[model samples]
Target chain A: MVSTYVTSSLILRILLVYLMVSRIAFAHDANEASAYTVQEIAEGNFVHEGNFPPQSLENRGDIANIGFIVGEKCVAVIDVGSSLHVGSMLKAAIQRVTRLPICAVIITHVHPDHLLGLNAFTKDDSITVYGHHRLPKQIRTRSRFYLESLEQYLGAGNTADHAIDPSLVTPVNGLLSIDLGNRVIELKSWDYAHTDHDLSVTDIKTGTFWAGDIVFSEHVPILDSNIRQYNAVLEELQKLDVQHYVVGHGSLDRPWDVLISEQRRYFRVLLREVRAAIVNDISLMDAVNTVGWTERDRWHNFDMYHRRNVTTSYTDLEWED
Target chain B: MNFVKRILTFIGASLLFCQLALATPFPEPDHSSIPEWIMIKQLMFGEREIRDGSDDILALYLNTKLDDSSTVPIMVNALMDQTEDKYIKTLYLVIDRNPIPTAGVFKFKPEAGRVKLETRLRFEKFSFIRAIVETNTGDLYMDQRWVQVAGGCSAPSGKNANDPSLGKMRFRMDDQIRLNEPNLVQFQIKHPNESTLASDLEPGYAARFIDKVAVEFNGKSIMSGDINFSLSDNPIFKFYFSPQAEGVLSVRAEDTHDTIFTDSVEIGTDKR
Candidate 1:
């Protein structure tokens, strides 16, 4: 009886050790509150196991981040990086992991830093790029001008044509998901808060949520047509139980609940004070004068942005009522 | 036996990985508890153009909201009392607002003309939009757009959002598309208007706000003002100026750290 018990116990220990080794291989370097991983890539789901080389025209510093995820069996590439170089580099990275075919590329949003690598994803079947309805429109409208600005900013190393036709566009509505073998990726859309159309992604395997532009990590949240709606959305993000949040511009974070919570509190406070200023008939000047303005110090050259935020918030408050 | 040990070890390893994957950047954020004084971080001064996408003149009217020690109506009275000017008409107070509650712009008709002056103001959250105009008769009309950003005074910079290096700051001037004499100029830049409640990515660190800006006309001071973080990045601003006065226009901005950015351009009177 003792030998039998020992034999079973030995087998259990071996199983435990094997699982431990696998887990150790994929450990995350950053400190997080929780952790998880993918089990397998299911069939029909696309896999981004190839590189979509960035166009020769993309400027450096213009590409923020790049990567792709799988849904069921097909794959979806997240970012193509700055230029043709980064895009190609990412494709190679994708090839290293999976052999599944890449079905489409989701721009996430319309910023050059995020979508300039469109050329890499275009394929014979005409790889579809998804974003908010306004996104493809924005890409077609501003590609040239933005290209000029990018060239001026990053110099010639990112030289290439910047025009992208809306023909390859696939606009996403409320929420969409990619089913990896044993994983699921959830993509959600928000108003023009960060930009004209911001799309976020979620990995169910690890519960790592990718917030393209909505959740900025250590970077600035670029503004667009609306700030009121933006603030409201930021407040709403708090309602999610996100574990890992990968912002469009910064590092990933665990316990996204905290990020959303803090952002919500901020907008609420801003609304109250601005409302008060209006009630007292503070001349836009006196209101500006009477109330002291602060915060945003460490941001390199934030003065220029401060003025814009004020205008956006004030307009939102006024129009809201 | 060895296989069993390996499986057990694998389970242990995976548990450890999970902990790191879900670690929160900042265990606790400073959502509340920020002092009122610490909220407002910067002061800014600039003129807002209140016009459709046309060259026609816009009349601006204004209201005020000073601390109880001094009411907006009282402040307006005091301002008029000091300016020795009477053309300033109308006053409205914004209310239910957490910060200051009174401030609005006065609208102007085609006849309200020839206006140029700088003034100081207050805000609750860093948000305040306005329209200003002057009539040929010295009648000043202004429109105030109240905002709901309560943390405006000290809203953290955008850099506090996620990636600071992704910082993209710019200074630009948009040329007048229509007429010359009363042309509208577009001024814009980008920066993270940080909120006071905003903590550094590592947590514990608080973001700062903006302070001052100097607008120069031909190397001379045209408009110098204070600012706050209530502003947004890549702030696009529009204002009306005496288009007839031809000179090299330069703008220099200074924030809390005393960081200075100077960009200049020549305003062409005949661009229209």
Candidate 2:
């Protein structure tokens, strides 16, 4: 009779423990629903591919791909997505895969699509944020404008509630290397290319190049820097012997050189036509609509950005010899 | 006589009703009639020959739908031949609904190649932007484009207005002045050209901008402009002038801050 009583208590305790453990598991599973589906592109490399859409309430600015690399000791996040919610999902994704501590969050540029979710990782003191040397100035100057745009597109409630504080950023002036156990990642800050403050990351083990916006896959290239300088950077990028490249936009399935050549063609057309327009004394008004228009069919979202690109390139190239 | 008077009254009433029923979405200018335009024309030209631009001698180009109110691009091309004897004497950019109707006044000499001028502007509201060209013979030809964009004069100045180079002036011209030919001269002044609407959002800040510009060739006024917030930040003006004699082409710009910036480009003779 005593043994029977102990057995009943034992079963009850086992059931209680099982209920508590499942509840905890269920909580994490719920978060995983919102979590990104990360694919292992290489050994210990995971990438979440996002849809190609403009920043709107429907998409909630989930229009840029973000991923992370796992080293033997820790992990490095390439980008944190576009909002605090997306960032939280990314963190959940990391937890689902491994329990390793996040060592660094590397921001490739100052674009909101890549940097707005930075606050998600800021709470963790172990994670150090890295950006280009010019990033702090850009963030200071442009953060307010970006926030205003974010509120307009994503609504006030959906915004990440993050403010750009330069003090928290560790600036990468030139080439710097970070060791994640057995893996070594090289970080390089580029000159006026995609933006004045653009950083690229390369994994020495897998030979994977994380080229922020420097290499766009399908999205129309935006020109915020000197077009001449951008072209020179593209030439320099072509010479690099990279095994695989992760671009800021478009499909990563295409070969790295193919994407580079395609981008180069767009830049070349813009330069040739804009210079010709300047020499022919065509006014900016006409040039904005007509210059480099032949490639309209080749690029996606060509109508949204091509004219502005022409305007930027024209204004910049007019001063060129 | 009584019958004729009754018919005239009926016609005038019908026309007024028709105008009110047009239902145009844009806000029409306060003074849109021929007589109203002539009143401003008389105020500006003072008994000059003003005629409708039926000949299409002057063309004004602007985007019908503009996204950026602060920096609007505008181009004016004068098709009339410009020679020493006769050329386009002046081009007046008139935005009917702006706080200042005269956006800019550009003077051109024969040496200005093709009589083409391009620059950026600011529009206060939805209205017609007229490019009135006056030839050397005192004949005025007008062409206009109805722009639907607004909020240019009163839009926020994205940059902080407290910068130190608020009224610095810069000039770009040919190193060698082509005498008796049209040489292009461009000048830019660094100022926020703040608008009252922009000031409304910032506490303890008042609107300020370059209010006047005087361009002189050899101390003779080529053109002078009275500007307001309708000009973009760091207001730029590009025009053509024939260097009559090698001297100085000086520009003096004054802002609401009571600061005057003066710059001059020496017109040296071109090497033969």
| Model 2: residues with Cα > 4 Å off, grouped in runs | A1-35, A156-160, B1-60, B65-71, B76-117, B121-213, B225-235, B240-272
Query: What are the RMSD figures for all models against the true structure?
Result: 20.2, 14.6
- Candidate 2 residue lDDT tens string, B151-187: 6665455445777866666667766777777777777
**Using TM-score as the measure, which candidate wins?**
2
lDDT at residue A160 of model 1 (Cα atoms): 63
lDDT digits (tens) for residues A12-94 of candidate 2: 87787667657756986685555558888778778888777565443556778888999999999998877776777788889
lDDT of model 2 at residue B61? 76
Model 2 global lDDT (CA atoms, 0 to 1): 0.77
- Candidate 1 accuracy as TM-score: 0.45
Model 2 root mean square deviation, Cα atoms: 14.6
Residue B147: error of model 2 in Å? 7.9
User: Residue A303 in candidate 1 has what lDDT?
Assistant: 44
